[model samples]
Target: MRTGAAATYDPFASYADPREPLFTSTVVSVIGNIGMGKSTCMKCLFVLRPLLLGRRVVVLDKKRQGAEGEYGPIARAMGTQPVRLVPGGGPGASCINLIDPRIGIATSSGAATSEGRPAGQLELVQRVIAEYLGHSLDVLGIEALRVALLAAPGRAAADSREPTLLDLIWCLQHPHDGQVRSLYDDSWTAADVYGWGREAAATLLVLANGELGGVIDGPTSPEVSVDHPAGLTVFDISSLPNSGPALGIVMLLIQTWLSGLLAQRSAARQQTILVVEEGWHVSSSASLGEMFREQAKLSRALGLCLVAGFHHPSDLPHGSPARALMKESSTLFLFGQSEEVEVRETLSIAQLPRELGDLIRSLPQGECVLVKAGADPEHVSIGISDWEAAVTNTDAQLTGDAYG
Candidate 1:
């Protein structure tokens, strides 16, 4: 076993070492309360350290410090701007196409599999609709959505562009006679098919033309690209309302898009680290949780690492996919938790000794317990330089100083 001071632990070094592999997969979970330096620990250990070793880092920044995202300064320091996503996208706003073919929405039957792109796209759409309706779709609703999505590409051929969310909505609104007959018996008419999809179309209308329109309804903007020269990409979704499904939908879509992008790359390419801050949005939602679980299975093969940060273990419900993913993490960082219940819950999830609960609860800022797979839990104190403190600081507004 690789033994060292917890403060000197380097996940990248440990993962790359073949003789004594500490982690089977590169999934890291950071759990702590707000303002306990969880983000700072992630930035210093996961983001900055990995970048030094030439690994790519992509952060889904949800927390807004003041006028911009908390990761905005870090991105700017790397000579790039956080890709800002706003509601009701207008001129100069970054937009991602929900139906973008680059996302690997399988258009042909040969490409469809239980765990393939077609199923992923189908699940993504269903999840989006469910988020809007506040519940999962019924059998008829799901079938209607599937049929409409399958027919959208063919209907968009006349437009000379890839099918957009609008095209799917159109397919639902106008179910062709031939398509309906092919899917169902002659007894099924276009009106009958449309009636089955009426609720889905209405829900889609909100996404394509209502308050959530323009962001995912149209084609992807020319300037929007995930490939960055600096190897650090931050998708800023702070402007979107936190109460609704918009934020969760965007995060899921980005993950799907990144997965597709990584799938197209050669295996020899450098590994990518995807950091999802305020990850409770993903863990709490059924759709997002299921999607994340699927991705977690493929992450190691795809040369991807998922760094998910949550305020507490309760954010991930018992037996949920997201919680299961947390349990499978190769490395876990437990920072200070003000609540004893939260500390115990976090320790339970980490499979650490419950006797250490009080120690975790009383951990000071910038200090945490590092629990790597196949190793004993060790206390780690993260050291930050003057420059790192300036860039990673999230409390500049309150402290009137750079450090957090």
Candidate 2:
């Protein structure tokens, strides 16, 4: 029903950086281990592409979430410090972050209460909340959320104006209420689904708290603090134990929210750029990978520009799922990768240069091969002249006090 016939839809374009011909969507996988410059490469592209070309941007962070003082400062310098958590302090615990601004979606802990009140049952809340996190989020403003509307595309002045991993997740999870749904009844246009999602998130929060009430009722408990809207939304996971799944879900859901937002913007003749670092962790899941693939299919229509940075191609998953990603990746950036047979196979299937099979062996940190349509993949050296290692920027102002 939604065609990408917006007056401003511009096809993505790029040159000789890749074996593929000229292309639009750029896929750069920075392959390296700890201390290696893998993340640095991702940061460079995150800042470069948009600043140099007036591209609307959204960067996904799952590894550590914020830029620490390092990456956070960089993002702030670029635009808005990525959106971070406010606080999820309720009778029970809400999986939702109070501070997230961009998407305004709430994640729930999941627990059923006779009258929206619970003593403390984290597990039950989480289960109930799971549905909210997995569903809803198409809404931007609603219950359990107190954030503001973010700037329109091309309106950001900072280097990065992104929603924190949490903010974006909440947005994707939040149902839009009766908004787009009224005009378009399809799933893509169903905005009222957001209210149901919030209820789900609230249920989960109560459940999360029920299990960890000991911590919440304690003196050190984090109280509920609402956040103002921000250009960048961040879901700080520094406190959560065993954060992999939580982070993965956050990334996937946020990516989905952005896809839908772009679709709406496309209809309005606007374009935006989105970037994801540590690409494999989120995109590797079969279900999650499929979501990314589906979003990619609409990238051109919504004027959605995307760049995914990862370690090894294998990290993205195997077989058909990984293969599908290759097709979506119009442009590919290959940094030095460990000699994983699977990684090589990924490149082979992606149509990487046969000669690079050996060259890929010697690639170093900061350097990468750019692949796009009509261009022969060429090795690019980002060595010394590149920006400083983009660690998590902790220097940015985080309203920890309000969170308290």
Candidate 3:
């Protein structure tokens, strides 16, 4: 994340003077075991000073405390509350309209086919199906769903009406006249294609009515806004089931939405920052990981920075997009890791000096080694003012109810 007069933001007084630029890396990674100060280190490195300077920020608060998450209180302090999503729906629950044309178009690649229709929409449907279902579809199922979505929005005025998973499910089960038959020759009847569509649609129905139905199925709630001027949008997916597949789907959608916003900001040259906690959920999926890697690669040109934090390097398995992100990150903060194996792996991935491994193993609380890509590492102790320290503490929810 670049900070300076160019960004129209200020640096922390303790770190740099207002006139001097501080923390000018485009991609940052924070790694450590839980309670080893990963969150606190991130807050010190990105949250406190940047927000104070009016740089809009978004965080995926996977810890899910609603108004009580690590960044929720800080976001509210900046004049907005974190948009919270809960299962079974609740007082502050927020639902995203996945079928909104705006969302669909945001993922649109602007690539058109021979028929002059945007090819991106079909790809968008394919991705949503893969992500939400937590698996891949057969070639027939993919084509069937594509045809259904092509009509879901009604080809002529696709965005005129909002299409829900129910609509897709219905289209899949019931052949649309010649549509289903066209997918195959007389060798296979329309019934065969419909069967595949029905199978794929069944999985989607689970996303619409099953555990995460409340959050992803319905008219988009007014609670969440992608364009917040205050510079902070936190999607508290904490309450969503932590099952790896389920979390991966929700996080992918959120990331897609943010990418759309970032794409829009490219012209303004706004320095956009996306901070994700427990990012392993995203990297675990090869598809999502590749998507993230592409986004990070495009960040510099788009004027965006990504800060991803997780408990251990294993969170991003070897050859994962997230691990690639770590390799590309110019700035990194290494908080102490309690486990010996994890520490060694993190150090290996981080390429820190072997001798520092022992120090990292026993590093005191709130102390971390700051390493910039291609530069010597610095063991800097994060020193925040008392009031700042209290506000950034992730444990405020543990000690008392004061955080919310």
Task: Give each model a TM-score.
Answer: 0.76, 0.55, 0.75
Give the least accurate 10-residue stretch of model 3, judged by summed lDDT.
Answer: 1-10
Q: Between prediction 1 and prediction 2, which has the larger lDDT?
A: 1
What's the lDDT for all of these models? 0.76, 0.44, 0.66
lDDT of 1: 0.76
lDDT of 1 by residue, 301-369 (tens): 777788888896776668887678788898898889988778877878888888778778788998888
lDDT string for model 3 (1-404, tens) is: 21222212222221134332344447778888788778776665577667676666777776744353567777666677776767656666777765554555443454445434445545555666787666678788887777676556553245564666566677777766666556554666667767768757787787777666777666666536667666778777766665545566666667667766786777676667777776445434455567667777787677777788867686566887778778777677788887888787877887776888887888788777777654467776766777667667676667774543
lDDT per residue as tens, model 2, 120-215: 222222332453355543333232232111211112224354323233234435534444454346654434444434554454345334433232
lDDT of 2 at 232: 33
lDDT preference between candidates 2 and 3, better one:
3
lDDT of 1 at 118: 64
Q: Which predicted model would earn the best lDDT? A: 1
